[model samples]
Target chain A: MAGYGTARQDHLRRLRRIEGQTRGLQRMVDDDKYCIDILTQVSAVTSALQSFALSLLEEHLAHCVAEATRNGGPEAQEKIKEASDAIGRLVRS
Target chain B: MAGYGTARQDHLRRLRRIEGQTRGLQRMVDDDKYCIDILTQVSAVTSALQSFALSLLEEHLAHCVAEATRNGGPEAQEKIKEASDAIGRLVRS
Candidate 1:
């Protein structure tokens, strides 16, 4: 977690921007925008969320997973499993 | 795109809620929340987006892809390819 401390603000800012994008998408739909336009917005939102997820995953790997592996115990195994599960879900999504 | 017309409003509402969640996540980080707690929120956001993507993909497959397959032309081929590419990216993400 401490490892992520430095990048925390950056991630927060990115998420906030994404939040605005999501709201804009909602407004587009509410306004009865063109079909392709709406779909394009959906694609953009999906890509933004995917990028965020990838960054978070990278942080988790470099910090939590690395620490757990270094510790070398049940906690390490649990952490690895948790990360694997997350990756599995992401890929499936 | 017309196929999605019926469910458009539903999707918009869902996206709006996700936007709120994203803003909340930003607030959590800004307030210096606990690491694990923030991570849990991240996981929730990821899951929400994943579900949205899955639903959109399903709609594309059932309506867009099915229509394209029925048409049986170059446009059909293009649509099929587009859907396949989208699915590929979603899975990779």
Candidate 2:
């Protein structure tokens, strides 16, 4: 679907950018940047990354998961289990 | 790397389960399940999905981003930028 494609593209772009920020944070450490400054950036990066994940999760639930559940069956049950385990990991982290 | 592989495998398993949860939610809707109950499950599913994304992002930062930044250069900078944008999107969502 066009909508899915657009969303995916956007998601990919954002992910790539996050990947870059992560690298920047590492560089800060290596360059011996001020501890406070590094920590601040690190915090921002963490929050930013967390926010992105939240968005994707929201979308997945609203669309993919919702649609699949509507159809109902073995596949649907599998998806629910998959989601539960995934969530468990996230919360644990 | 073996570590990455193990982590990836774990992540994949979680994702698949979440996928199943979403489907279950859909079935509930079709079955005309109670609104409150459905909403409860939906909320749980949302939380679970978010957790999965967070873990992946954390890993990316700890392993991929950190390593790339240590090596330093255009590639590292690029990765940092990618991460930033991704975080921005996540927060926005």
Candidate 3:
């Protein structure tokens, strides 16, 4: 959890900005902005989001799952399951 | 970048565990582990990864992109572009 906190804070900040970018994208749409321009922003937001996600995924694997395995048990197995599901959602999303 | 440091460490830790799970999965495959069991582990890793990604995206939106927008300029737009592209990759990957 301690590991998650700092990371969580960082993620929160990034998300907020992405939120604004999304709004801007909406405005661009509303104002009849150029297709390329809108697409460009869309691409940017997407990349930003991916980078953020990557960071988190990395941590979950390193800390959470690793700790579980080290501790050893059914819970560790459960943790592994949980992590895999998360990746699936990310890919699909 | 300062914000990224603590977050990065957390991510690294999680990644290590996911890596181990992946190895286990590979072994399971080699050992002819049950299909359901293998898939289940895969799903778990995926979910964990996604959770991590989500957190990072959130931070990017809140801090980096927000700062860019608040500062106001082409850089912000560029940053927006960067972020969007990232999300696109995440979705596709």
Candidate 4:
């Protein structure tokens, strides 16, 4: 797999932040916070994570998929299928 | 605020699934799963949640923002600002 390098670091940071948010959510539930309030926080955390995914997907396209396309043949086809499957998953999610 | 109705239900279902995934993650940790394995599952759950978020964001943009934009004037500006802020947060996340 192609390394994301700097982008990987940024993503890890975001993931760690999201992990903290998830822990906070668990705490909120344990503390019996208002349902609506907890839901709102959940929404925020979801959005943040989604943004991170979008960034990663963008990077994959700009680098991995693009590189595969440039190379052509079976590898390109596989990359295209992978990207399509990913997008399909996102759409149905 | 306008309701998402069926779309809301879909989102809720997806969220519930994600909640289950999160619990599974916790269990994985409790069971002392290998670091790389846990990280792989974490990535999967993160991607699933991100897909859910992206769906919600797309709906918001297509529905709420579009409605506001059609209305024009101060409300339009507010909606536009809201969407921009949301995108900004997603980018920075």
TM-score of each: 0.69, 0.47, 0.48, 0.53
TM-scores for chain B, in order? Answer: 0.90, 0.82, 0.82, 0.87
Lowest summed lDDT across 10 adjacent residues in model 1 chain B is found at B34-43
RMSD of 4: 9.3
Off by over 4 Å in 4: A1-3, B1-93
Given candidate 2, what's the lDDT at residue B63?
A: 67
lDDT of each residue in B1-93, candidate 1, tens digit only = 355567887887788788889888788777766445555665677667667667766776777777878988898888877777766665554
- lDDT comparison, 2 vs 4, better candidate: 4
Number of the candidate with higher TM-score, 2 or 4 = 4
Q: What lDDT would candidate 1 get against the real structure?
A: 0.72
| Candidate with more favorable, higher DockQ: 3 or 4 | 3
Q: lDDT tens digits, residues A20-69, model 3?
A: 99999999999999999999999899888877876776566445654665
lDDT (10s digit) by residue, model 2, range A15-93: 4554455456445444544333443454554454455455556665666667779999887787677667655544543
Q: What does candidate 1's lDDT look like per residue over A1-93, in tens digits?
A: 344677887887788888888888778667756444555555676677667667767877888889889999899998888778777665655
lDDT of 4: 0.60
Candidate achieving the largest TM-score: 1
| Whole-model lDDT per candidate | 0.72, 0.54, 0.72, 0.60
User: Candidate 2 lDDT, tens digit per residue, B1-93?
Assistant: 411334655655664565565556445545544333444554554455456555656666776678779999887887677767656644543
Steric clash pairs (candidate 1): none
For each candidate in turn, give its C-alpha RMSD to the true structure in angstroms: 3.9, 13.9, 15.8, 9.3
Worst 10 residues of 1 chain A by lDDT: A32-41
